[model samples]
Target: MAEYMRLRQICLVAPQLAPVIADISAIMGLDVCYRDGNVAKYGLENALLPVDTILLEVVAPFQPGPGTAAGRFIEKTGGRGGYMAIFACEDPDARGAKANAMGVRTANVITHAPYHGVQLHPRDCRAAFIEFNHTDGSDDILGPYPPAGPDWQKSIRKDTTLSLTEVEMQSPEPEGLAAHWGRIIGIPADGPVVKLPNNTFRFVKGDSEIMSGLTFKVVDKAKVLEAAKARGCAVKGDEFLLSGVTFKLTA
Candidate 1:
């Protein structure tokens, strides 16, 4: 298999799936692709929406406590940090081994037939959980993403939100954090940004290290902002706060 990697999905955590999922769908004009029942085993419920080809997911723990990792993540960051950045790659095991060699422990390894994923410890990863996954015999960018459900692509709506353009990671030492993430993702940092095949990860200075914001290309910036305001989101300038991260709208 040829070596390649791209940001496949971005996960966000919320106290409840409600208004977060509803607000994002309403404001961005996105459709809910799937609500994975597989997560119930972990005492959680999730909903995934297609932001173009990339999946945008929000997970909330129904049983909120130390028993679940999602619950612990919410408490640790006070629900401020984004949960995970999942990448579709050629080899997940090789990537996990590389991260392990660098002292980053593997938090979990999930395998369900064709799909295989390796999640690195969020504490060691700093900003958020880093996951590398691959689906057997599916190398095409839009092909069989098990996590996003069987017909996720059918729900793709580009009328309002076109695509997820960038992910903004914030840390006190942005440059260092960028370099660290670059090493893990095997993409060398260009100053404070790691440019990927489909999207860009930009690190900026902040009080703590976390995935702070997401930038999106939309059809009409004003319309999106209006929808956000209607949904009771904290809208300011060309951005809004929903599910603990800023949604920056762009042309």
Candidate 2:
């Protein structure tokens, strides 16, 4: 079985970039590393931020045409959920082949010298788009993540958000959803949780299949909430709904 090294990043899609990108940067105290021009092929614009070694990305469609997958996601969830859960692996092709053999749809394969990736179809995975990638000679978690653009690691700011600990996937049937994802990702479901090496995928009961929320290990939860509340996000307890997804801060 192929093993995922770590939870590489969480990708979120928003209807618009402005307030969504602004709120995430201000509230979470994360630095915007790069505005990737690479996604132009998909008719989308994106911003990448380093949340420690793990990344937080938000993509919005520049063109609302057939090429915009992010636009499709926003329309599907009514702009109310997470989009993709990406993982870093030693060899993504092995995992991609495994998923392929299981009848899962392999969506895309991107390679640029040292970096290579395979994206799995969301319809087959059932909850979120699953992507796996590897940097040719680098196994370090803090090494180059080519998808985030160069100079991405230089943007790491740990004074506020420390780590992305959990990614929440929601569905009407949590157990079954987790099981389906488990078969695809090669991770066993712990009841409703898909336990990974560094973090966990939490399958929660909800109306539809979507990546719903993220749990962040933070330095100041109060400060984050205050910033989020000021930005007009729907705050409930320590969590807030922003960019069509939930942000849960924990110390």
Candidate 3:
């Protein structure tokens, strides 16, 4: 089995992409890295933001077609909150095979083309697009998954203060979801909090069986909430307003 790196990114979808991107930037203090042109096939556009090298991507559908599955994902999840959680892997193929061994099928495999990526079904992950990917020959993880084009580093801008940091997950069956993800990623699923070298995955159960709402680690969780509140975003405990997406703050 191949060892993996820290958590890489989390993807969010919006009915429209630009506003959400703006919202995340204004609210979270993150810088937009670039938008990937390849997403045009799925009738979608995307922007990548760096939170300590953990990519935060916001995507919106521009048109529905063969390549973009954003439409189907939106329809299935009734819009948005947290769409996908992507992680770094030393060997995507090896990890992909591990997932397959556990009865989880790969949804797609993106290779050499730039980055090597493999996605597992959400059902297997309990409602999330779990991707394990690595860029060939370089530990410069962010550069491989180009936000705009295949020029490699053109899309990645490192933020020394920003760390991929932490991820919070809300699921109806927290333990079950964690365990399921553990099998998929070869990580232990024993607690509410699963910590990695550069990040953490925290799980909490809610009323519905579906997973929802996520919190990303920021420099100041309180400041993020205050900023959002001032901008007319509703704040309830750790989460803020819903505009097809829910942003939460957790330490």
Best by TM-score: 1
| C-alpha lDDT of candidate 2 relative to the true structure | 0.85
Per-model TM values vs. the true structure = 0.98, 0.95, 0.83
Model 1, residue 181: distance off in Å is 0.4
- The sequence of per-residue lDDT tens digits that candidate 1 reaches over residues 1-251 is 88998999999999899878888988999999999999999899999999999999999999777668889888888889689999999999999999999999999999997999999999899989999999986688788988999888899998999999999999999999999999999999999999999999999999999999999999999999999998888888999988889999899
Q: Judged by TM-score relative to the true structure, which candidate is superior, 1 or 2?
A: 1
* Candidate 2 lDDT, 191-249, residue by residue in tens: 89889888888999998888888999999999889999899988899999988788998
**Which window of 10 residues has the lowest lDDT sum in candidate 2?**
1-10
> What RMSD, rounded to one decimal, does every model reach?
0.8, 1.6, 3.4
Relative to the unseen true structure, what is the C-alpha lDDT of residue 79 in candidate 3, on a scale of 0 to 100? Answer: 77
For model 1, state the Cα shift of residue 107 in Å: 0.5
Worst 10 residues of 1 by lDDT: 63-72
* Best-to-worst lDDT order: 1, 2, 3
Give the clash count for model 2. Answer: 0
TM-score of 3: 0.83
- Top model number, lDDT: 1
Model 1: residues with Cα > 4 Å off, grouped in runs? none
